[model samples]
Target: MPNTRWTIVTGASSGIGAEIARQFSAIGHNLVLVARRREKMEALAAELTAADRGFVEIVELDLAEPDAPAKLHAQVTQMGLGVHTLVNNAGFGLRGEFVDLGLEEQVTMIELNVTALTRLSRLFLPDLIKRGQGGILNVSSLAAFQAGPHMAVYHATKAYVLSLSEALHEEAKPFGVTVTALCPGATESEFGARAGMEGSRLFSRARMDAARVAKIGVEAYRAGHAVSTPGTRNKLVKALGRVLPRSVMRKAAGEMVG
Candidate 1:
């Protein structure tokens, strides 16, 4: 009675999202790739299927769009695909003073990062619970541990992810559903460029490979780890953030990311 097939990967068009999709496909899991760019997803679907014989379904939908979660649920149901895994990775960071970054962008980040993630996890929970086995991997960041100065809203959204994932992990334990928060440190991705952080001196030193990060996250999710911070440095930083006074860690983190 194993409910096998179709893992939904949000933000699968690029970066960590794309890498996670690729890893799942490599392991012979059927995939449903969701993102705003249809062409990119189609291309990825082609590449993954061509490289191997894995099944890939491309759905181009903006997670930030209202009613997105409902539509996504309907589409999956109509396709007769039962989701056994969910990867909430579709989120972005806006760099700049919170007041100057424009209220719209800040709101959109919350909609996608916190709102969509919550809705999707809730929508899929019943199905997973009935089946008695499933997994959810939420892609958070090292920024979740402390308040960010310039990237205030983005950091706050990730903190929500981390907190929610941990709580859900414990709640879902008896139901046989595992929830994990994959907190990655600075990685080589187009995230900087998208967030207007291109060519910044802060990113010159953060050089983790995207593939490696994806691998670690997938393995951790499979192993049922409640939280997995990939790199040692990131793990240490999170530990310090947990133990240090909020004021002290906040200032240090702001300076580091600033």
Candidate 2:
């Protein structure tokens, strides 16, 4: 490393994480791709390398594990790379009634989606604040706008992410650090299959492309937007919880999960 500022993107093996990495790299930002899948990262790194846009480093990690955020921060510090941005995108979702799901798995979802994201943001934010630039692009979801049925835990985690990111943005913006909460609707990714939502009505139709979602997120972060809802009608996400009756929104969310 030749004294470079880097962007750390977690869960960077596939889908939005991978696409976001590409987006940043295209704009000439070196990246540290963190995830459990080394081979996947290697392939992505190869692709980015061939583009000759920016350097790509891979850190294989399970962010759900305790101490992962600390370890990753330490490793990045040891390598002498100053982090410019931290993309807290390492997360997953499961679709099912909360009570019917395995307890440990649900907890793990919380660990990765909420705890890990918070830890990484805490560890890396001071650096951005000190530099008076850079940003944190958190991959929240449109589901954060309302309570989701069948995917209760996942929705709750995303809600937490959205709320936390917005607060951080308000605090960091004065210092010139942007914290963007990207609230994209259903996108073409492994998330649907992994969460068992692929067969659901919400995903039965054509979904937004992962590349498009990533592009929108990167644009939002660069523009210092606090929250972004990609591929939505009017994109007035704040209106969802207010315009619709709480009961009606809840029922509609449940019906979509069918």
What C-alpha lDDT, on a 0 to 100 scale, does residue 157 get in candidate 1? 96
Residue 26's lDDT in candidate 2 = 84
**Given candidate 2, what's the lDDT at residue 13?**
94
**Model 1 worst lDDT run, 10 consecutive residues:** 198-207
- Tens-digit per-residue lDDT, 165-256, candidate 1: 99999998899999999999788887888887665455767668889999999999999999999988788888998789999998887776
Root-mean-square deviation of each candidate, in angstroms? 1.7, 1.6
The CA root-mean-square deviation of candidate 1, after full C-alpha superposition on the true structure, stands at: 1.7
Tell me the number of clashing residue pairs for each predicted model. 0, 0
lDDT of 2 by residue, 162-237 (tens): 9999999999999989999999888898899999998898899668899999999999899989998887652654
Which candidate comes out best when scored by lDDT?
2
Candidate 2's C-alpha lDDT? 0.91
